[model samples]
Target: MLVLGLQGSPRRKSNTFILLDRFLQEARTKGCQTFMLEVCRKQILPCKELVICEKNGECPLLDDMHDQIYTLLRRADVVVMATPIFFYNVPAQLKALIDRTQTLWARKYRLALTDPKRSFRKGFVLAQGATRGKNLFEGLQLTTKYFFDAIGATPAGNLYYWKIEKPGDMAAHPTFSEDVRKAAADLLDPLVRRRRVLFVDRDGAGLAPMAWAFCQIHAGDRIDADFAGIAPAGTLRPFLETAMTAKGIDMGFFRPQSINELAPSFSPQQVVALGADVMETVASRFEKDPVEMTCWELPTFDTQDSEQISRLCKAIEEKVQESFGMA
Candidate 1:
């Protein structure tokens, strides 16, 4: 699992950064990969209001956002926005990032496309204010809710503090560390509890992607599913995309990767090989633990036939359900 933290404080060692650092470190201890983005340091342009995203789901302003941040937002399993309350809201830097997510919003609502990982993604807010106002976090909270919605992530948890303005203040607080630890556990335990399943196919263009997509739709919360190929094709087959779209699943941002590319990072508890050729490669590469491996002999058919494509997808979905105990 990847936990991405957007540190919104301008100062290097400010209270907001301190809290975010500790929180992300706790997440790392809980067996998650963590990436921190210093939003202030990056050149994130504010929304130009050109309405280009609504028209075509593309942002005109070219900067780090266009270069890298948008892809990070989509790939993140958990997004943590950390900032000090600036006039009861987040700082301008972080707000720019939020506003630019309109591209994602337009893609989902206007274009009717969906990110494959959206259903299982989560968002969290960690904020603090100088004064203890009753509604200190209200504006930020509402903004975060809409932001999470735009990015297709559920608002999972929040940790807000007040009257902690100075540097080292949060670190000095008696309960800050404990609070962050507990919050990290509360947010991550359920996801960590789910079993990790990896689906392998020969070319990654057909059956493996279908199984992975359906598993994401049907058993995403219960199974942490990943798919790859022993020899990846340049892209997914057209009929596979067509079949998935028929089921209302938009195969947005799908990439084909070889087993060697993913095996170093992902450790699956269960491995399902859709082809016999890849099983030996998978078993040889994942020689660490005794991962439960099974092979399914799916019917091979012409990729151009729509009926054959639909039938293949159905069989793959059924195998996915049965293998993951979703049946």
Candidate 2:
């Protein structure tokens, strides 16, 4: 799992940063890949209300928001936003980043596209306030809830600290270490509990991605479905997106991965190979403990023919349903 932390403090060494850094460190110890983006240091500009995102599902702004942030938001399994309460809300720089997520909201709500990981992605908040006001976190929590929806992540947890202002104030709080440990466990344990299933193909250009998507669409709650190729083609096959779109599924965010690249980190409880070549490759390469493997027969077809593509999708969906029980 990937845990992405958005540090919202303008000062790099502020109490907000310290709290976020410690939380991310705990996540790393749990075998998670963690990344922290200092939002105040980035070149993220405020949303200009261009309406281009609502109309075309694309942001016209040519900055870091377009280049990198959008992909990170979409790919992250867990997103943690750490901020100091500025007038009961968030800092302007962090608010700008939230505003830019309007593009992501537009993509999902207006264009009706679905991110494959949307179903399981989680969002969290960590906030600190200088005052002991009763409503210290009210506005922040409300805005964050909507922000989580816009990004396709369910609001999982919020850790709020009051009367914390100075540089080292947060660290001096009672239960600082215990709170971080418990919160990290509560957020991450359930994610790792799901059954892991992997789908493999010759190139991951077509068959494996299709099977992976179908498995998720049908049984995402019970299975964590992953797809890769023996020798990745580095992209999806032609007509793959169109085939998925016809079934009301979006394949725009899907990317081909290599088994050799993912095997080092991901160990699957179940493996499904599209052909004998892929099965052989997986058997020889995967050194993980006790995995169940199954091979599916592949049929020759012309990629240009729509009918052939439709049949292939149906075949893959049936196989997925048979292997992993239908939702």
Residue pairs with backbone atoms closer than 3 Å in model 2 (clashes): none
lDDT, residue 147, model 2: 94
- Per-model C-alpha lDDT, please? 0.85, 0.85
- Angstrom error at residue 40, model 2: 3.2
Q: Point out where model 2 deviates above 4 Å.
A: 233-235
Question: How displaced is residue 266 in candidate 2, in Å?
Answer: 2.3
Best prediction by TM-score: 2
lDDT of 2: 0.85
The estimated TM-scores of all candidates read 0.87, 0.89
lDDT of 1 by residue, 111-223 (tens): 78767778889999999989987999999988999999998899998889989988888889889899999999999889877788888898877788888888877887888
TM-score of 2: 0.89
